[model samples]
Target: MAQPDVPWPLLRSVEALADAPLAQIADRLRQATLPYMGSSALVIFTEDCTGRPQKKAGEEEIISRVSITELDSLRATIPDEAPWFGHAEIAGRSRAVLALKYAPSHALLVLTDPQPLESTPTPGLEMVRYLWRIAARRIQEKVADAPPSYLLESRAASAERLRVTAELTDLHSTTLETLLAALRSPSLDDAAARSTVTDLAAKALVALRTLSDRTTDLVEEPVATAFERLREDLKPLTRFGGVEVEFIEPPLNGRALPGEVAHAARAIVRGLVLTMMEEPEVSRIRTQWDCDGENLLINIRDNGSGTLSADAPSIVRLDRRVQALTGHLQLEVMPGWGADVFVTLPLDPPTRPAGDVAEWNLAARELEVLQHLVAGRRNRTIAMTLGISENTVKFHVRNLFKKLDVNSRTEVVALAHSHGIR
Candidate 1:
C-alpha cells in the first residue's frame, strides 16, 4: 500500500526551523505553535533531567515572569514520549500547560492568555505534538550533521571574540566621531566643548573596558593555556615571597573549560599559594591538575608547618569561591606535615539535587538510561539491560546529553556522581 503524505505546512515549518540559527529556533517554534496554542505567551524551553533550564528562546517578559518552580512542578507530572495537556495556575492565573518530548531535549510549551484552553479546539494538542516532532527531528538532524562538539564550541567562542572586537572598534570610531562633531559645532564655548569631550571619553573608556571583560569571559581557554596563564600570574607573588612553585601538568589534549571556570580556578590556586608563601618557613609549593573524565581534580601541597588551619581567613575565602562554582574544597592539614588542598570542580555546571531529578521531566525510559549512565554502563550494556536496541540507547543518550548540557558520557557520570545520583 502507498504511504500517506504528510502535510505541506508541517514540512515547511520543519524546514524553517532546520535552517534557522540556534538563537532563532525558539522564536520559530513559538510562531509555529501560536496558531494552535493561541497562548498569550508561548514559552518553548529545554530543561535537563534535573529540571535545570539549559537554553530558552521566547518572549522576554513572559519567560522572566514564569516561575521555575511551576515549570518544575509541570515537569514532574509530564510523561516522556507523550504529550501532557492540563490547566494549571501560573503567575497567579490559570493557563494551559502542554509538556512534550522534543527529541534531544524536553520542552515545556506553555500557553497563557486571554484565550483559554476551553476556547481552543482539542485538535490543537495533536497539532502541537506533530509540530514538536518535526522540530525535534530537525534539531537532531542538525546536531548529527554538525562537527565535533569541541570544535563547535571553539568556533562559537571564536565568533563571540570577533563580535566583541568589532563592537570595540565601532565604539572607538563612534567616540571619535562624536568628539569631532562636537569640536566643529560653533554653538558651544571652548570650555563646554572640552567638558563634553572629557565626559564622553570617560564614559567611552568605561564602556570599552566592560565590553572587553565580557568578551574575555565568553572566550574558551584550553586547560593547558589556563594553567600557563596561572603560572605567569603567580610569578610575581612567588618571586616576592621567596617561594619556589611547581606545577605538574595534566594532558593538554583534554577538553577545554569555559573562561570563567578557568579564571576562577587560577585565582583560587593563586590565593592558596600566596597563603602558603606567607608562612615564614614555607619555601616550596606544588600543584597539579588531573582530568579524570568529568571533574578537574586539583591537588596543591606546600612545604610548610602543617599548622595552617582550614578555618583561616585566606582558606575560608578560597573555600567560599570554590563553593560558588558548585565545587568542593577539602584541606588535609597534617599538623607537622605540609597541607594538601584537594578541589573538585566540575567541567560543566554542577548537577541539580537528587530529589530534583524527578523535576527534570525525564521520561521513564530516559530515567532508566540515566541510571545506567550513572552506573558507568556503556551504551551497548544499557541497551541489553533495558532490552532496547543500541540505536534506541543512543537516542536516549543524546537526549540526556542535551538535558545535562554535557557532550560526553564521562561528563554525564561525573555530574550524576556530584548530585549523588549514583
Candidate 2:
C-alpha cells in the first residue's frame, strides 16, 4: 500500500523544478506548484544571482510590471519564514498575495492572486514552500558553480541595471523637485490647496530619494561585509576539504562593492581555493583582501608544491571573471614556494569609453551595440537581447568599428576599456 500524496505525478513535478535551467527555473516552479496552488504570477528574488536578481513567471501584465522596490517592501513586511497571506502592493497596485522568504539566503517568493487547488490551503502552502526551498538552493549552487558564459552575462546585466537605475533616479528626482518648487510658489492664491499640493510633492520627493538609495544598496555591499560573506561561502570547504585556510580581512572603512563584484569576488576565491586543494601536496591556504580606495586587491596563496598551473582551466576562468570587471590577475609560481595569485578589481566603472559622446560621432544604435560588445556578448546574443537581427547588429558593429577606428573585436574591446567605456 502506498500513500496517495506520494504519487508519480508529485515526483515528476519535483524533478522538473530541480532540473530546470536558470532562465527556466521560475517557469518550472510555477508549473510544479500549479497542482497545489494557482497564482496569476510568481516572482523570485535572490541576491545570490546578482546578474538577474529576479526570476519571474506568470501573467505578463503582472510579472512584467513588478518592481524591486515593491518586492523589497513586501519582503520587509514578512519579517520571517512564515508565508504571509494578505493584500500587498504589487505591480503598482494592491493585490491578494502569498509571500514567503527563504531565511538563510534572504530570498523572496511571491504568488499573486493565489488560490489552493485542493480545498485545504495548508497542504498546498506546505508543498509550495518545500519546492521553493529547492529552487532557491538550486539558484545558489548554480551561481556558485556558474560557467564562463553565465559570468559574462551576469556582469553585463549588472552594469545595464546600474545604468538604468541611475537614469531613472535622476529623472524622477528632477521631476519631483520641480513639482515641489511649483507648488510652493508665493503667488499661489489658495493657501489650503497650495499647502496640500506642496505637502504631497515634498513627500513624493522624499520617496523618490529613498528609492534611489534603495537601488544603491541593492547594487553594492560594504567591503568588510563582502569579505565576511566570502569566508562564509567557503566554510564548508575549509571544514572538510582537509586544508587549513587563513582569512585576512579587509578594512572596515573600505568602500562598498557593487553586487556583481561582490558575487564575482566570492566565486573567484572559491574557485581558486578548490583548484589549490586538488594538489596532493597542498596543506594550507591563505587569502586576503585590501582596498586602496580605487581597487580591491586580493591575494590567495597556497602552501603546496608550487606546481599550481596558471594555465589550469579553473584559473583561466577566474581570470576572465577578473578581466570582465576591468581588473587584473597575476599568477606567480615559484617552483617550490607554492603559487601566489594576485587579483585587482577596480572600484569604479571604466570611464565611459568616449570622454564626450560627440567624440565617437556614432548613431544611438551604434552606441547600444558597442555597449553590448563591451559586455563580451557575441553579436548573436546582442541581436537576440536587443530584439534586432544579427545582420542589423553587424551593420551597427561595422559602423562602430569605423567610428572608433578599431578593426577587430579584440581591439574594439581593448580600446573601449582603455577609454573607460565600462
Q: Using TM-score, give the best candidate's number.
A: 2
The C-alpha lDDT values of all candidates are: 0.65, 0.82
Per-prediction CA RMSD (Å): 21.5, 8.5
Candidate 2 per-residue C-alpha lDDT over 1-422 given as tens digits, one digit per residue, 9 for 90 to 100: 98556477777978987787787888899998888999999999888776577888899788768888999998998879999999998999999999999987899999999998777444998999999999988887787667654655455455555665677778988898888778788877888998888888788878877887887788789999999988888899889988999999899999988776788788889889999999768999999999888888999999888887778898988888788777899999977779999999887665543455577787888888888988878999999999999999999988886776443464466555555676
Instruction: Look at candidate 1 and give me any clashing residue pairs.
Output: 40-112, 49-360, 51-360
Give each model a TM-score: 0.35, 0.75
lDDT of 2 at 17: 79
Q: What are the per-residue Cα lDDT tens digits for candidate 1 across 306-369?
A: 8788889999978876776668999998766778999988766533455456655689999899
